[model samples]
Target: MAKKMLRSVLFACLGNICWSLIAEAAFRKLVTDQNVSDNWRIDSAATSTYDRGNPPDFRGQSCMKRHGTPMSHVAWWVTEEDFTTSDYILCMDESNLRDLKRKSNQVKNCKAKTELLGNYDPQKQLAIEDPYYGNDSDFEVVYQQCARCCRAFLEKAH
Candidate 1:
């Protein structure tokens, strides 16, 4: 029997406090539920230095709790190594996608395929809006979107 190759994905957003963190937890849940958690590396990062070293937003945490999804991550800015080490770098929206693409260009031999996470949304919702300034209801919307996109992406990946 051959060993399975490890795949990796890094989720990104401006602050890494809301959208990306939600997506990371959602994707992690999907992979764990599918019994393939051992074959993948999952993480989330910020496109900028904003909120670096901080835990996810309180509302995002509450949202995940409500959905029964577990999340443990600190905000960190995306690095050049991420471009080379990850299989895919999925971001929340167009601005994030553009930031990731531009950063990838600066890294020599960047191998990650960066794109908007919403591209995998079955409902054709192409952007995961930032919910930092919104209330719990907004965070709920982010969770729903992440759940949908993560499930779709995991299905296509495996």
Candidate 2:
């Protein structure tokens, strides 16, 4: 009887290991595959919708809230999904890159990238900054970086 119980426990352990491996493979596939052709990826992230949280059911009304006061809204935290999904995850600045990497296993893939939509370059390491708290001129700086990085990404993503 003890032998039979030991065999049963061994079978359960083997089943669990196989299941875990399969789950891990599925997760890795989700992170690495860039199936989307477009550059913009908007999902429920820290900045998108936060603390108030979302109801499992939207019901008749919406529980969603604004991301702070538009111009002042600073929901800039990145999620694992961002790194996993973006064809080329672009960080506005070194700080943003650090935050993104902290939530990622793709630290090797994370880089100081701009979010610029067009007019960019390669072989350059420029970090873009978010347009917040700083002077209006700072926003332009952010714009330039974003434009350059985005342009570079667009040129390369295809």
Candidate 3:
């Protein structure tokens, strides 16, 4: 039998420990609930090296647990291969969007359409703020935003 094409998506942020991690987890759950997990590849990465090799923030973990969304991820920076591979490089905030676009241009065969994840938000929120400096409530807000955006994104994917 012929293999199905896998659509690659890379979620990115200044630090992979917060917003991006939430996005990756939310999208993963959305696809799993839809039973289309096998049709897509989802990953999260940072635009900066500051949080590279670290795990998702504790607040984010707590938020996920509160939402019953299972998520485990180690932070890493976006690479040239990621630029050339992902169909969509979705990011939180203008900083991440600018960083990814700048990095994408450095790669000759960049294929990913880098854009703000909030672009998919049904509520018209234009940016998903980094909750690293905030408390658990901030993380919860991030989770809610990610869930909304991810759901909209999946719907549009179909």
* TM-score of each prediction: 0.97, 0.41, 0.96
Q: Which candidate is the best by TM-score?
A: 1
For model 3, which pairs clash? none
Worst 10 residues of 1 by lDDT: 65-74
Greater-TM-score candidate between 2 and 3: 3
- Prediction 2 TM-score vs. true: 0.41
Candidate 2 Cα outliers beyond 4 Å, as residue runs = 1-77, 106-125
Stretches of candidate 3 above 4 Å error?
1-3
Write model 1 residue lDDT over 1-158, tens digit each, in one string. 99999999999999988889999999998898889999999999999997999988888888898889978888999999999999999999999988888889899989999999999999999999999888999999988999999999988888
Can you write out model 3's per-residue Cα lDDT over 8-114, one digit (the tens) per residue? 99999998999999999999988998899999999999999998889888889988988789889888999999988899999999988888888888999889999
- Top-down TM-score ranking: 1, 3, 2
> Count of backbone clashes for each model?
0, 6, 0
**TM-score of model 3 relative to the true fold?**
0.96
Candidate 1 deviant stretches above 4 angstroms: none
Ranking by lDDT, best first?
1, 3, 2
lDDT of each: 0.92, 0.31, 0.91
RMSD per model, one decimal: 0.8, 17.7, 1.2
